[model samples]
Target: MYAIVEIAGQQFKVAKDQRVFVNRLASEEGQEVSFDNVLLIGDGDNVTLGAPAIDGAQVSAKVLKHLKGDKVIVFKKKRRKGYRVKNGHRQSLTEIVIEGITASGAKKAAPKKETKKADAPKAKKATGKADDLKKIEGAGPKAAEAMVNAGLDTFAKVADAKPEELSKILSEASSRLAHIVTETWPKQAKLAAEGKWDELKELQDRLDGGIEK
Candidate 1:
């Protein structure tokens, strides 16, 4: 059986055990992720299609690793109204191998539940709290809001995030926010997460719009 599914804004024809490289996702390496936007499924002579996306039809895959694509001179961020940068860039990608395709009775709740359970223990009441990301230079209201919407709501998550990942998330969120430099965000976030206000302020003072000076 094979399925056509949308993953990270791109559609692919995938089958069991087939490997694919997709845009960088929030999932960690070795994590299992499912795409519910299955467009069509085919088995032998039988086929099923979706009106836009197939409900209860899902594709499961395992994240292998994160990597960078070939460098390019014209950096084209993928989004409607996306603009190009005049500098070189390497696209961030995630390698995944399709595990299975379910034509029906497939939902994203299972994995989400597991994720919640995994996070519930340590966070407890801290779940609802989010850091004020506007403290980071160049991460204006739009950029900060974009990162929060992408599940990097906490300082720790931002601290651990790569600049490329942040850039992709920002670019995907909106074309207007695409140009915000994120190079110093993680470093600033790390200091903030560690409660080193003095150091973070010093770092911010030395930065020029999130770029090291």
Candidate 2:
């Protein structure tokens, strides 16, 4: 059997158990990932092609290793000027072992939420609660939690938060996501402070390149 599929925004024809090198993905060696952009499938004498993408078809693969591809030498020269430039490039790659193909593709599912379980110790409520706060629009859960721990729970507090204040507080926590707080936290706080929710949404859409609300 042979199938046409898309991987990492590029398309190729593949078959079951085939080995292929693709652009590196965020997977550890020996991990697995699935691809659904099976554009066409053929077995024996029967073949099917999608108008754009094949519906209800899937391909799965396992990463055998992460590797750097063969070096590509680039040389540029201006014959009359005696100028030459040479460079070598190595593309990051993942070596994959095709697992199997399924005609019925996997359905997209909603992301899982934190589950509440009785008998377990009651989880501490997040500290970053602000008056009139609905959601911190661009904040991730851990970042929000850090803000709560710092006693700046509400959007109102965040909006008026001086860069120096946040730097001082979060600097003691962890430096990994510190830059994000400096960049996105102040803007989010301002929106919350002024109750300019729509304006904040507009700014987010602009930054994210989304169509107008």
| Candidate 2's TM-score | 0.49
Provide the overall lDDT of each model, using Cα atoms, as 2-decimal numbers: 0.80, 0.65
The sequence of per-residue lDDT tens digits that candidate 1 reaches over residues 138-212 is: 688888778887788888999999998998788667645544567788999999899999998888767643456
Query: How do the predictions measure up, each by TM-score?
Result: 0.53, 0.49
What's the CA error at residue 148 for candidate 2, in Å? 28
Tens digits of per-residue lDDT for model 2, 1-213 = 888887764677888899998765545688888877788889889898887777778889998996777879889999899999986656666789888887664675465355632333222434334443335543566556666666676776777787557654554444333323244557756886788889887676544211112
Candidate 2 off by > 4 Å: 78-82, 109-213
lDDT of model number 2: 0.65
Top candidate by TM-score: 1
Candidate 1: Cα lDDT at 86: 64
